[model samples]
Target: MKIAVIVQDGFEAFGLGVLTEVWNEPYHPEDDNPVFDFVVCTPRPGRVKGPAYDLFVDHGLEATEDADMVAVTAKRDIASPSPEVAEALRTASARGAQIFSSCSGAFILGEAGLLDGRECTTHWRYAERLQAAFPLAKVNPDVLYVDDGNILTGAGSAGGIDASLYLMRRLYGAKTAATAARRIVVPPRRDGGQQQFVRTPLGQTEADTLAPLLQWASERLDEQLSVERLAAEAHMSPRTFARRFRDETGTTPLQWLTSQRLALAEELLENSTLPVEQIATRVGFANAAAFRHHFAATRGSSPQAYRKTFSCCEEETAEQAV
Candidate 1:
């Protein structure tokens, strides 16, 4: 695959680093992992100064024309990408190439009219500005990244890594993506979204007070848990407990518990050979039917299908052991 990463003057070094980390670096050469033909492109093929240092690129705007994926790294003066660069991005998009942007690069996509009416995201600090500047684009402030088919937008910093790996997972299989993630010391998959990283108004004291209860609940995901039981454990009435839980966790107790269970189920499905029904029971679901319904609704796929698609364990090995 050919990957053209468009770098402009005053570009963010971390953004370029992530692009190179996920695509340019070969993680498992012994296993014959796919290697991308990665090249840095600029509006003018010459020395461009990034925030920390300078980089020289021989490829110009034309480098993106034949690329399978064109990524716009975050940069300063984001609202004003050169016309040649914008046109190259638009031409790539029109030709069905996968287009990606990290952080403030969403502004470049907006300038190119690629974000119009598309569900996209950027850093939380710039979400409001991005939405205001491009009213036609739906900027989701609470997601790490938004994959609107061919056009993908990532949030700040580490979100670019997540978005890049997600693209790898989509192109290759989950095992291949997991191998890359392990090599880089990042989680193969992360649940929830940017909401997990948002700083809440809750005081540290209040959050600390609920730490034990939260830990206890997390450790017992295989057992049925209820608001009443949790409230009793915390020595508070159900109403007060529920309110305190919301204040500390930024979500309802039931919702928090459900998300934890779903996360555990996903881990088990990916790494273990447990049957779907057995996995459902172990995750505290009443039965396989309820598990399937919730998994389908939340993850957009049946548990069985998800396991089949992402499972890293071998079926023949499991069958022989059984």
Candidate 2:
């Protein structure tokens, strides 16, 4: 993939660092990770002021024209982009290139009219500002990110990582995204629908130690593991476990399990030749019918359809054989 990161004066170093970590070369984000053609550009090919330092950017906005993806790193001031930069982005988008914004970079995108009529997000603090600025845009403040097809916008701080990994998964497949995430030491995936920030108590409670239980439950997806069962295993009362789970994960136990199961199912669909029914059972669904219901609800596709699109081995399923 050819990716160009656009930066400007006052660009948030944290957001830029996160974009670099996910995309810029030498990290080997996939088996095909070596394929990234990364570039950095500014509106002008000269000194650009960051929050703490000045960077001598070598390339100009012209570089975005032929890029497969153009990422806008956040600026603390949320200023509008230069005419040259905005034009370059719109030109790239017209040619079917992906456009992404990390954190408050959505301001630039909104300025360029890309966010108009699109579902987008940014730091919760700036969500109202963004909406007020771009009246036509649908600003979803609660999500970590919003994948509006060609235009992907991330929330504040860690939201960029989530969006970047999602872009990789969308382009390269689940295994590649997972590998890149492991290298970065972040969870493999977080639903974009997940909260921008958890509203849990600031301090960790005794029952907040749910990592071991989560891992254990993930490994035992084939078995029936209810909240009570998980609570017993965690040595906590069921009520305490449920409260702690919600606090720590920002989701209920059943939602988390269903997400985990679907994630595993995605990998199996891409990497294995298992039948749909068997994969369903292995992922803790009571039966294929129930699995199909949840899969379509969450993934927007039936299991067979998902396998057909994402299967990596180039082998045909029984459905494809007909």
Candidate 3:
């Protein structure tokens, strides 16, 4: 497949490097895999200046017209998307070609109207902005990437690498993607989602927020802790507690609790051999059916499938070298 990476002035060098590194290799006997045909294109097809350097590109947006995948590289200026670039992306999309954007490059896709009514994601920092700019699109700020059919959106450079490997796995096979990832020294997959990566605090007022309650709740996810119960625990009424919870966590009580439960479920699935039913009860999901429903809704995969991909031995092998 021909993969065209489109860039503009002040484009992110790391994003371009990631796409090139992942897709622009030749067949290697050691890896025993074939790579995609890759080319870098831009609006002007000349020297493209990045934040720290410049790169001369001989190809123009026309390179994307017939490419199987058009990767829009994030640029410093997402406010204005070139008409030629949008045309190239639309051309690719209209032909059923896969279109991808790394980080804020999703704004370019939004400008082209490709993200309308589709599930997508970007770095958590820009998720709100992306949604404000394109209200019709469903922006998921918590996932590392969203593979909504032909249009794919990745969070950051690391998420870009993960999504690229996932695409490789989808097109080729697990062994092929693993080989490619090994060649680059990255994990074959990162399935914990982007929730943990959101370390930025909401504001200075967070110091007075419900940190104690949240910590306590997180530790007891295996127990039934409803809003009323939590409200009494925090010495606030249910309505007041719910309001305060949203103000502090930027989500509702149920949403926050579900997210915490899902995080715990992920850990259990990755590091334990418990059956799905037992794991569900362990995570306070009421039953396996409810757990499966929420897990698939948020993580986009079944618990069993996630375990199959990320499960590992709980303890180090006795005979293995440390």
Clashes of each: 0, 1, 0
**What's the candidate order when arranged by decreasing lDDT?**
2, 1, 3
How would you encode candidate 1's per-residue C-alpha lDDT over 1-322 as one tens digit per residue? 9999999998999999999988997645566568889999998889999777999999898889899999999888766646777898899999999999989999989999999999999988899999999999999988889899799999886799888888898788777787789878998766425353434465667777788998999999888899999999999999999988877776788878878888789888888888889988998888999888888987889987887777777685367568
Q: Tell me the TM-score of each prediction against the true structure.
A: 0.87, 0.87, 0.66
**lDDT by residue (tens digit), candidate 2, 1-322:** 7899999898888888898888874844335564578899998789999879888999988889889999988886765546777788888888899999968888888888899899999999899999998999999998899988799999996899999998888888776787789888998788888877666655657435888999899999999999999999989999998998888888899999998898888888888888889999999999989989999998889988887777875455554567
lDDT of 1 at 158: 78
Per-candidate Cα lDDT values, in order, are 0.85, 0.86, 0.83
Error of 1 at 193 (Å): 4.3
Which residue pairs of candidate 3 clash? none
The TM-score, computed over Cα atoms with residue i paired to residue i, of candidate 1 is 0.87
Q: Residue 305 in candidate 2 has what lDDT?
A: 83
Give me the candidate number with maximum TM-score: 2
Location of the lowest summed lDDT over 10 successive residues in candidate 3: 313-322
Write candidate 3's Cα lDDT for 47-149 as tens digits: 9989999999999888998899999999998787578888888989999999998799999999999999999998888999999999999999887888987
**How many residue pairs clash in model 1?**
0
